[model samples]
Target: MKHFYKAMIGLDLTEMDDILIKKTIVYLDFLGIEKCYFVHVAKDLAVPDEILRNHPELLAPGDESIEALIKNKLREFDFPASMDIEVSAEEGSHPLDTFLRWAKIKDVDLIIMGRKEELAGTGSLAKGVATKAPCSVLLLQEKRPPGLPKKIMIPSDFSDHTDLIYDFGERISKEMGAELVPVHLYEVPQGYSKTGKTFEEFSEIMKKNAQDDFNRFIQKFNHNGLTCRFILNDGEGQGKALLEEAKLIEADMILLGSRGRTKSAAILLGSVAEKVVLANNILPMLIFKKKGETMGFFEALFKV
Candidate 1:
């Protein structure tokens, strides 16, 4: 199905956070829809139990503090309320599980979440969800401060999932019409950058490779049909490199496949993809998940 109402459920509340929320609000507003839900799940036990017991109080007069606070947040964005504001509280050990459950129950077409840091490996949240979740995820990432969209940076490694954008990025990018910046960032070649910044020595080769990848993808489509800018970097983190390139190009958004190479190595790798989603800049983002590579045998049978 298609996602009509947009919702976000994270609260590290920063400039980058605001940017993503703001962008969602803008899109919903433009669509002339008012029933969007922006859920702020209180994962911690800090909220008093007394308040939890009186769950109805969220909408009660004088008890409307939280409700108003949430509405005020929406109002701040110039988005109108079409559906009654609903606040839910639940006790759960893992925030990801709680969110996934809620998303399933609500039949949410899109799930928006923010990451505080972009750590790699088994600990990443963004990577985890994008890989396993039942719905499409929009990870609002801000590397730089909130800014206008002069570019839209897409980080890819030519993997099946990342390049399998005929549906995800293609549909969204058409609506955005911002510069489709396709970036390929590689780690420095083993022998080079032995001591200093890894990008120092291998930058040129990476740039050339980026150009080749750009041409290859372009050839897959009609030339001069879509406007875009190409870039490359040899660096430590692909996420960080994408953010820097976003700022350099004054990008308005970032589109990427949620997890990286190790998507199936463990649980959802939403956290792995979190690096790009948690930027300080207010750029909107869309994260897609390609469950697995199409097996050659399966492809041949299907073609038959």
Candidate 2:
């Protein structure tokens, strides 16, 4: 499978720092991304006349001094000039709107953002962008992984889209020379006692059932060049269990699939993926939609 070549990175100026700036460069370098754009949207791009007069630099030229500053910092990193990169700053009512619009205009294949702990909630801007983006999104919560990932974790619910999820997971694992761990999180029925079985017994039965499905899911796929394994976690919270498993295995990254906004209006980014991201997990996460998927409300309303 071909890798993501065109990339768009969303930047929140208030949270900018040396570490995240460096991580962005590292990701572009590792992915061999050919064209990249660093974008920032200012909610209050217009300054009061008095303040502007006092500080003319605030609206330097195109009111893009922040973008210019970021570009200068990136230049200090000394990445090869061959990588095509541009900086964009825009004034908009909402940051998410600006980002999604920029992504469409540029035809970006991958969207990258630094995971802000405060904005990791369901209604936060990060969730909006991830849910509405036209392409894949990589949420980075820490410094870049030292090299290509050694282990990529995929939390599966055995949904109908598991095939597409597995295919992309396999492709990424093979590219990174990493092992694929497909995990299923299960929970016993609420009224298991009605089945004439103890909670422990019922839990074990459900675990086995999930394991069987996971195994069959793996067997149906052709992962000749990749190492794939199944992990079954019987627990209450799927997101918590997945994170614990990833930490236990020292997984470098987590690959997940979104149900797409069109699937359901309430659950954006899927409940599990949202919890995992909002939990402030340390691993990088790549959440994407199925290929050829149609645009959702946000995408259609904000078309470039």
Candidate 3:
């Protein structure tokens, strides 16, 4: 079964666009992506009057030039003839709004974009789309090597969210022949000694309890014959611990589940997911969201 049939890729006209497009092609088969929409949104597409006067040879409209440029960049890649590809260069005061609108209009199942690290970018656009897009978002780090992931790390709290995370992980693992490493971070309570146990003993007990919870959770899904790792938080935050574990295991991709936001909440993404998205600059991260789960909320929020 295909998880992502259609995807929208956000391009900033920076070098990152090359990385994003290349990675998308690499994972197109693994993701079961049949169609891709390459979209670039600028704050203002109109060329400045001074620059236009200085260079009268540039007569084409701003959007048309950008669209042509993107098309030319894509021509360098030999995409499958069966793939449906389209490019759009648009103007919007807020690029995020334009991205979300185009994503909804196209009914994309996933949004692919890049996260800047060594590159000269704040990565705010990637974060905004990951948090607010109606579909799942794949963030490719600017410095990371572009290819299919060998090991996919998933952080599980053993909640309903874990189910979603595992579902995606298993699908990707099966399709791409990657290994699934489910990681669960457990913490001992501050007052564990009150239970008449030493800190070390309590830590072991907490670990055991986490293992038990994981076993129960895993029973619900097939998991493609994989195991879950139980780690002690050791005072660090969950987000930090997750990244550390990903490094220790040499995971190339991090799969996370976003609980999304309610109508009253100010933020759309959960705090842990946001932290991971911001701090992670080495690994490609896939922030999965159940399609249409928050469509009503987004439509109202964006006034669609």
Candidate 4:
């Protein structure tokens, strides 16, 4: 079974850290995760000379203090004894760069981070990690409770990458005893009326075409006799349509594949994935990616 082995959780030393830790514990067994790295990055670890002179008791480095606090927080929870857990507090002006570096160094297979809605920090870190990380990323909604998903919604385009997305969805569903809901969004052409068809007629045609494609695509995968629901969306925006369907189905999580860009490209995630990440603030989303698929590009882009 394809499963995540090592996961890195980004901590900000806020209340969100507790939620993320609890969520990680809930998913460790389901994802088959063997190791975890709880990492916190500070903009600067240097203390001002003036402040240090006044407070001579503050002799320890900032990283040490931050690391100790994180360790104490972890002690509050009861993690599995068999899992290898590591805590790191590092100084980096650009946190996304630091996270990517650590993920590569640790050979991490998954990166889990909190997506703030009414929380303190903006969700840019989670978006950036989802866009550029070499491995998969799970963006947990701060407002949502952490637990096993009952139904995972996957947005499929019937591309070659859909196979990879379905593989992950199937593995997670089977292990966690959840249902798989695959959604396909189709759009009617701008000049559908030119084909002597009404707008409504053209819409139905598009939906039927999408259903045909989905039937063929799903024929190749073994769903383990699970009840898989197929949905068709013909809305204006693919990302928005997918989210609406997720809400209609009361999905617990949204899982989708990301066709990452090369080093020369301006963006990493495709347009729809990026849009969904930006607008979504309700459900936990897992962006699946082939591990180490972009290592060469990342090395060149970062000049490592």
Candidate 5:
């Protein structure tokens, strides 16, 4: 349950709120983050040349930068003596690109930000960063708990990535003294009855297989002081099912494995991670692409 020392937090000016900053602070404290950077990219703000000449008051004073404003808000929270903070505000046509560049330049271990529903020019920057960023990315929507999350939900399909997701959830749960809930959803595909088995029979077999996998997954972890539980749900549409389960258990956060699906697979069947991120904007989601499973150039360029 070691902490992420260096972190970068991205801020959306339009969605700025005290709660988001407060949550960032809580996460920093929870992780014992040593150094933190806050960054905000101001979208295109075109003003007429005539207005600038006549209306001088329209522009902020020299000392009143957006980064300064965000830093002032962050002052409301209590940071540890060991932690240092920095802030940046930039204007760019591509906010996502700006965020990635800053993150790479800084070599941050974690990137935090709020999820945007839909902006005119930027179409889900959170999704883009989650998919392409070198380090782990955390995307939070509004209305999270004031403090560190108490219960975290992790989705699993029993792939090689499942163990990584579970390990992350376990670390967070142990560090924050939260509960880790692993959810696995399964459903039989259509036309499976052609195998001569009833739909109910097929479903039962699939559920059994999922349960066995879930059991095997848990056996690998040592749940010494952690409260870990497994949830086996029956249905298709992993994103929808995950949302329903999170609500059912009242989960405060979600941990997912990035690069969980291929581009063609996502297009044909719809990606679970993308759907959940898009559908559940209120919950905080941490997406991690495992160390060796990096995305290729074309995939990073055009996948989202």
Candidate 6:
């Protein structure tokens, strides 16, 4: 596991003491993420510039009550190790700007934050941070059930870039003693919709295409075990349908690589992966970047 020693967490007041927040920090600690830099941006501070400098209504000279709040919340966490936890608050007129600037300065390897409800401006945050973050970001939700430790679910379309998540997910599953699941949505063409075939007939055809793609997707990972739970689904929109399938499978975590054929594939795919993250409802998404002609772990560790 890559060590996440210098870590930062972006937080809001509503996310205070969230179970996902605690579990994420604990998981990182288990994987050797020592010395966490916890940051919380206050939401409702509307002090004008004139009041901030001349009057200073909300805060005193070097007043740090908000900073103290971060510490107190961190103390509530059950950390596995004695890691240095620095608490700070970023002050700005806007919430997004304040948090983003702090993240840039810290230069942390991983950032953890709680997911808000779908309607309450959280989707906008996921879109902004996933595209613009200085490092890999992990999005956490409050009170997610601890599901299948030995079974992981991943959606793939087998592009050159989508293939990278296969290796990445394999490593994480190996560490946690879990199995990997690769899913493909079988959306038929618009003309096929008028056929009105029976589901059994439709399923047979979709399953055939899905299995062929799945086999090619796993060809590179020889050491990866061959047992996988295959799923076949058809829908109008890619994102909504996948979430429904994920619930049916009872997947522990949804993992996806950022690679798509459409616009802004690097940042926005609107695929199952992106929607799972934005929906921020049923599961937590672990996103991986699949770019460049890179070396594998064995090559990096032994050869280097």
lDDT of 6 by residue, 47-165 (tens): 33553564443463322655654465666675544677787766666656556567656656666666655324444554566544444566655556533355667777766566567
lDDT of the candidates, in the order given: 0.52, 0.69, 0.81, 0.78, 0.66, 0.59
Q: What overall lDDT, based on C-alpha atoms, would model 6 receive against the true structure?
A: 0.59
Q: How displaced is residue 73 in candidate 3, in Å?
A: 0.7
Residue-level lDDT of model 5, residues 1-304, one tens digit each, is 3446788887764444455676776677566678888887655534335634654554664224455556656765554446688887776788777777787678777888776444333437767777667677777666555567888887767665566667777777777888887777777867888999987798888887887776665566543343334444455456777888899899988888764455322211127776777667767887765433443432454446
At residue 247, candidate 3 shows an lDDT of 98
Compared with the true structure, what per-residue lDDT tens digits does model 2 show for residues 1-304? 3467888877665443344566766677556689888887768755447645655666675456666666766778675578888888788887787777888778777888776544333336666776667778887774444345788888777656667778888776767678888766677777889999988798789877877776666576653443334444455466777888889888888988876435433224678777777664477888866534634544656553
Query: TM-scores, in order shown?
Result: 0.62, 0.82, 0.88, 0.87, 0.78, 0.74
**Residues 1-304, model 4: lDDT tens digits:** 3378999999887788888888788888877898899898768766546645655665678776566666766778876767888988878889889888998889888999988888788878888898888888888888888788999988777766667788878877877788888876677778888899987788888888877777676676643343334444555566777788889999999997776343333226777777778778789999888775666666676774
Give the deviation of candidate 3 from the true structure as CA RMSD: 3.2
| Clash count, one per candidate | 22, 0, 0, 0, 0, 0
Instruction: Between candidates 3 and 4, name the one with more favorable lDDT.
Output: 3
Clashing pairs in 3: none
Considering summed lDDT, which 10 consecutive residues are worst modelled in model 4?
259-268
RMSD of each: 8.1, 4.2, 3.2, 3.9, 5.2, 7.2
Greater lDDT among 1 and 4 belongs to 4
Q: What lDDT would candidate 2 get against the real structure?
A: 0.69
Sort by lDDT, best first: 3, 4, 2, 5, 6, 1
Please report the candidate that would top lDDT against the real structure. Answer: 3
lDDT of 1 by residue, 237-287 (tens): 656767777778776667766444453332234343556654433455666
Better of 1 and 2 by lDDT: 2
